[model samples]
Target chain A: MIWVNTIVQGILLGGLYALFAAGLSLVFGIMRLVNLAHGDLIVLGAYLILLLVTLLGLSPFVAVLVAAPAMFALGWALQRYMLNRVLGDDILPPLLVTFGLSIVLQNALLEGFSADSQRLPTAGLASASIELGAINVGVLPLMTLVTAVLVIVVLNQIFYRTRLGRAFRATSDDAVTASLMGIKPANIFAVATGIAMIIVTIAALYLGTRANFDPSVGPARLIYAFEAVIIGGLGSLWGTLLGGIIIGLAQTLGAAINPEWQILSGHIAFLLVLLVRPRGLFPRAVD
Target chain B: MTLINASSHRVEIATSASRLAAIAGFVIVVLLFAAPAFVSRRLLQDLFFILTMLGLAQCWNLLAGYGGLVSIGQQAFVGIGAYALFGTSILLGVNPVPAILIGGVVAALLAIPTAFFAFRLAGAYFAIGTWVIAEIVRLLVAQWKMLGGGTGTSLPNSIRREFWFTETIQDLFGVRAAASRDILAYWLALILVLSVIGGIYWLLRSRRGLALSAVRDNLQAARSVGVDALRMRWFVFISAAFGTGMIGALIYMQKARISPDAAFSVQDWTAYVIFIVVIGGIGTIEGPIIGVLVFFILQALLADFGSWYLMILGVIGIAVMLFAPRGLWGLFSDRTGIQLFPIRRRLVRPMISNDKREG
Candidate 1:
């Protein structure tokens, strides 16, 4: 029963990891550039949601709706203006530029938000619980898990079924070729990043409502998101969720045993997985 | 006769430029060697840090610039090495020197496995793979109980207690350079830098260098010419790991301590090294050295500003990537074709004009 509880909490935490990583996977799948600033963006989205909830006296869910689209625009503009310029044959440029961007974002957030932590007001919803047999789960955490599943489903639809998705796939396959086919790769990239930003907003909603966060928290979030993306095997969205669960489980279980083990266990799990399957659990065949 | 005259003038300019570059390189090396003799204690210590960064940049350059692998996780090896030295000496009861050697070996061993996984990834995937491994190691090391879990572990009692003062000798000739921990570290870093560059210089001049360069320029063509891409990549990757590991151990030796966060800091190895290599230029043996010195000086000058130094570094990194794509050393190399440490053979033929007579 205790083991079940540990696993349950682990699985629920996986939802957060999944949310953090889905946006990253989407961006990476479409554009071969990894945004080192991803975690900061997620934190920014969370802060945005927090602002909306606090200022407008809105519920967290309602605040997410408002924040998501706003983040989308930010992502679009960021890619079009800043990130797009750095994508090229030489990988160092993009990596260096993004690293600089990460520092810039972290520092800018530090300036705007201050180093003091801020959390969204969840009231009793955070304490609300759903009872299942002998086990009980926090309503907020359950909702987060559901949100992650929904985001993945919706993103998968956008990627496979939608015309926009086709354009994204075409662009991902070969940008120059896609441009020759009249599909503007840059616009597609901007849209992908925008969509990723919107996902980030969702992740932010959960993060803000669930725990205390400061500006410096983003890089750690980035590590989780990065781990999930890699563990899930890069291009596959659904696989990312499993990866998140693995990381979440490793961490929570490690924490259950010895609190310090929490962070370390996740990393150990990540390395063990790498040792076994270098391409990840569900790596893209081509990738 | 007009064409001949023009060619002759071009020859004169190229020869003079090469001559000037050789002179400059010679002077720089001499100055660098003489730094410890002239500099104050603090400045000399700072130079050690600069040398460490230079070593890292060079290792990164060899992998990314020459071998065409863009790794963002070199810090994993660095952290591993630092901790390995600190851990081996304290935890395993090894001497500091042996501990550092073990750190290098540990990095190499780690690299073999990491390469197995990372090599599966290409381009962006490869970069991400490296990053994931780095984070994995960092996290695990921080968690391991024997190593001092999350809050972090300090160096063992033996290692901490072991930093003996260098015997002071008053010599008339050259101050005999008082040997202290910092000085010792500085000398170690200097020797490592020289050896690493020497090894790289030799590597680039060998047939293997041709294969590596060929792979970097054109993979398919290199494969057609019988250059095994995977083999070259693994070799370069392992070499980078060894160099990075040695750098890590060297750093820890100076501090005489290790913290998981500091040991595994990608911020120092990946971010700073990338910044240095990018500004000074990437791909050349001497590029990273120049880059490290320039970055260190900037860092020192801007140490007064709390966060402004980071902003400046970011701005420089961004600017260099945008405008100076080939980097500072690259720009220098292109302008004059000066192979300061010639790893490649250049066919230099005197220009013969229609009117110019052969000597």
Candidate 2:
């Protein structure tokens, strides 16, 4: 029963990890930039949602509706103006540029809102849990998991079935070639970031609603997202979900065995996976 | 091959010139060692911080400059090393100094597999791959009970509880106790800074160095030229990991405590090093060193301005990329035909501009 409970909790936690990474994966899949500010952006998105919730007295779920597009626009403009300028053969420039951005965002958030962590109030939503015959699961965690699946499905559908998604993949494959074919690579990147930011907003909603968050929490979230992306593979959505689960499982199992082993165990799992298959479990062949 | 002509061309210009740089290094080291005797102790502490940043810059140079892997996740190693030192010393009953090395090795071991996992990702995948791995380690660490979980881990307040072999400095230098501690920190930082720079220089000067550059400049071409791109990259990756890990250990040793947030802060690792390298110049030997100096000075001066400093760094990086993409050191290289640490050879040619241009 303890094992079952841990697995259930792990699966739900995996959802949050998947959400955290979805934006990062999408951006990388479209444009080969690993935004160092990814985690910060998620924090920023959460902050945006927090503001919406505060101003309108709306629930966190409704607040996301208002914040997602706003965050999307912020992401779009940022990529269009800042990130696009740095994309090139030399990786140092883009990495450096993003690093600067990360510091700026972190400090900005710190200045605006002191170092004290803030939590999104969900009233009883977080505490509310339904007993499923043999076990009970928190509403927040279940929602996070469902939302993770939904985000993945929507992102996948967009990537495969939508024209913009086609453009995104094309740009990812060959930016120069995509440009020659009359698709503006920069615009595609902006749109991809916009979409990714929307996902970030969703991730942020869950991040804030489910747990305590401060300005400094972005990097930790970024790390989890990064692990999720790595475990799944570079460019696959379903793979991200699985990756999140793997990490979630590793942590929970590690915790079950010995609390200290939790973090070490996930890293060990990551290393073991690398030792066996370095390209990740489901790397996109074309990529 | 005109070996005679080339040797003669390099003869007057190379060895005698390098002597000056070597002398400068000696003088700098001497002045640095003596810094605690004259300067305010607080200033000495700041200088020590500069040294660690310098070491970080050098590691960045080795990774992005020599190895061709531009990593944004180096902080993960830095944080891990910090925590590893703390963990080993606090948890496992290891001595602090040895634990620093132990921390570094732990970071190195972790990096070996991480490099393999991340290496498969080219361009962004690799960058993101490293970042993700770091994040995973951090998240796991955050939840671990023994390591202070999310709140963080602290060490003994007094570093004096650790070993002390520097009694000679107390008698001769007149810089005692706290000042002497600063001196030790300064020297340790200097040693790390020099060692990392030296390591990178040595690596680049080796046959493997040529392969590293070949892989960086052009992977397919290097493969055709009999360079084992994969192995060369992996080796450099591990070397970078080891160096970064040491820096992390040193960082925690000085800072005296390690938290999940502080240990694995991506912002410091990803951006500051990147900024230092770019502002100083990426892909050059002295770039990170110069970059670190300039950046640290600016940081000490302007960190109080908070967001303004960040804006300046961002603008500087973007401006550097736009107008001076090569970096500060790169600009210097272009202006004067001088290189203190020559990684690439530029054979002297006759001043027959017209003939060369026509050809």
Best by TM-score: 1
Give DockQ for candidates 1 onward, in order.
0.56, 0.39
* Clashing residue pairs, backbone N/CA/C < 3 A, model 1: B4-B353, B4-B354
In order, candidate lDDTs are: 0.82, 0.80
Task: Report the error of model 1 at residue B317, Å.
Answer: 1.2
Candidate 2 chain A: 10-residue stretch with minimal lDDT: A270-279
Deviating ranges (above 4 Å) for candidate 1: A53-58, A272-277, A281-285, B1-27, B91-99, B143-165, B168-179, B335-339, B342-344, B350-359
Candidate 2 regions with alpha-carbon error over 4 angstroms: A256-266, B1-26, B33-37, B73-123, B128-165, B245-271, B303-323, B335-338, B349-359
Clashing residue pairs found in predicted model 2: A223-B135, A263-B140, B79-B263
TM-score of the second chain, each candidate in turn, equals 0.85, 0.89
**What is the clash tally of candidate 2?**
3
* Residue-level lDDT tens digits of model 2 in A213-240: 8888886677677777877887888998
lDDT per residue for candidate 1 within A1-287, as digits (tens), equals: 98899999999999999999999989888887788889989888888888888789998889989988899999999899878988876666777777777877776777677889988888788889989987899999899899899999999898889999999999888888989999998899999999999999989888888999988788789878888988898799998999998999999999999875688688778778877887789989354
Top candidate by DockQ: 1
Model 1, residue A174: displacement in angstroms?
A: 4.0
True-vs-predicted CA distance for residue B271, candidate 1, Å: 1.3
